[model samples]
Target: MEKVSEKVRQIIQPGEHSYVFSKYLEPIAHVKPGEVVEIYTKDAFENRITSEKDLPSQILGDYLNPQTGPIYIDGAEPGDTLVVHIIDIEPDRDWAVSVMKESFGGLTSTDLTPMLQDPLPEKVWIYKIEDGMVRCNDQLNFPLRPFLGTIGTAPEVEALSALTPFNHGGNMDVPDTKPGNKVYLPVRTEGAFFFTGDAHAGQGDGELCGVALEISARVRLKFELIKNKEIKWPRIESDSEYMVVGSARPMEDAARIAYSELIKWMEEMGWDKFEAYQALTQIGKLHVGNMVDTYYSLVAKIDKKYTKLD
Candidate 1:
């Protein structure tokens, strides 16, 4: 990971953080469109629960992911679109953490999915970062794949928890929220109250255990506003694909919402509704974001070639 340079127009340190997305929270800093900014973020655990002996049930509080800011974007207003271009994400620490707590994982007897059986035993695994790889164990090492786990603009009236992912885009945990991708969020209040955090050094699809390679990070981002371009859900654009995220209960519902939103976006881009639905039926791809949060998240994606008019 390269060091942040002087070219950044603003630097938001992880001094004051928030655990909820609310229109009422005071703006940490104000930024204009097209200005580059650097944000520092803590891991999902907020750097608590360091070793195997530090049990999450004892060390952690009610909140999990601590977000950096509710950055007020100049000229942004309700019904507008906030465009975030991720420039880069670099791990701020040499080590990362992942853990399994009692009744907290997807496969375990979580509070949402109560089972009569016993919950999974708690455990912790601290991964080492070296040579651009995350050393999981002595025998396994994989390349770094950094991304933000929670990111979104505030909802108009609700003060939602940072762990919840909904229309306002909270803890989606989608690995696609990485460097080089552009995330488009709907603005529900003035200035778009943007918040982001929960840096993952790496994660697999579905974030199976309800955790990833949690790490602190320095993220570079650029903001832009698209006036009057309101989207129902968060949309992501990469060099090759266009993706939309949806969060809901009953995993299948999340999938349906994602596909529905993708089809709607396609219709807005000139494809007939039926045609877009048919096209998606033939070529759309699905990526699981998380199955362990308050609401499960799914991403519907399609290649850019399929959307071309030529």
Candidate 2:
């Protein structure tokens, strides 16, 4: 969908140095249960990597994936759910950059994986955004499928990095989070402090590389609080389907968690015991979000039509 510029109830700007999602972080802005907001988020590297000569290894010391706003929503509390509607995602800059991380990706392990092998060389690719597409290169080109790579409500426990996806919805990198989609995040604290960043002009499933077509984006969103719904994981819904998102290590566990959550949610949707399982087995699709983060993410999706059985 083409980016739309409309009125928003509030506008939130990005903060510096603080990239993690935690309940302790103070709320930047507050909104009612149903409100639209325009948020400006920095690129994953906070717009530090502008040139190929600029080493992400050197520039990204700690300020990575800087998100905008832990926006407070009124009437939101623990055990409730925050429903985020993706109204629009517009690239703020004409250029975007992607990186091949030196030591931290699916290819090798650094602090997280802990291996003796040296990290890979940092490779940067700058793309020019034009004609409704981001030109990767002369040989490689694709449409501008921009979406937020990281979005989450603050976690109740310890502060978590914007690099990992958790129950509160951190860096899931799910490609399904585009315009017209609604992501239901479980509320962990009062007001549902939420943040978003890491916009990608284009990315494939299972973001095999650590980096995507990372770009700064002006994201338009609508928020609503689900008063009584208690969700165990992040759930997303589009015009046609419902998706359950789960993040974890070892990859398959993430997949398992997503499908399991889908089944559980389906049970609550008026399906008899095991009926949801039987139905999902025939109509579900597993979408790989990314495998290169601190935790891999998987999304289980089933078309809504399948759920309306006679």
Highest lDDT among the candidates is held by which one? 1
Q: In model 2, which runs have C-alpha deviations exceeding 4 angstroms?
A: 1-6, 14-17
Q: After superposition, how far is residue 119 of candidate 1 from its true place, in Å?
A: 1.5
lDDT of 1 by residue, 1-310 (tens): 2233546865564455899999898889899998888888889998886776888888998888999888999999999999999889889889888898888878888898898998888888888898989996877577899999999999999899999999999999999999989999999999999999999998998888898999989989988899999899999999999999999999899999999999999988899999999999999999899999999999999999999865
lDDT of 2 by residue, 1-310 (tens): 4244555764656345358888787778888765667788888888889998888877877557887877888998888999998998999999889888877777787677788877788888899999988887777677889898988898877889888798889899998888889899999888888889898888888877778899998888888888877898999999889899999988899988999999988887888758888887888899889988889899999999888857
RMSD of 2: 1.9
The whole-model lDDT of each prediction reads 0.90, 0.85
- Prediction 1 TM-score vs. true: 0.96
The most accurate candidate by TM-score is 1
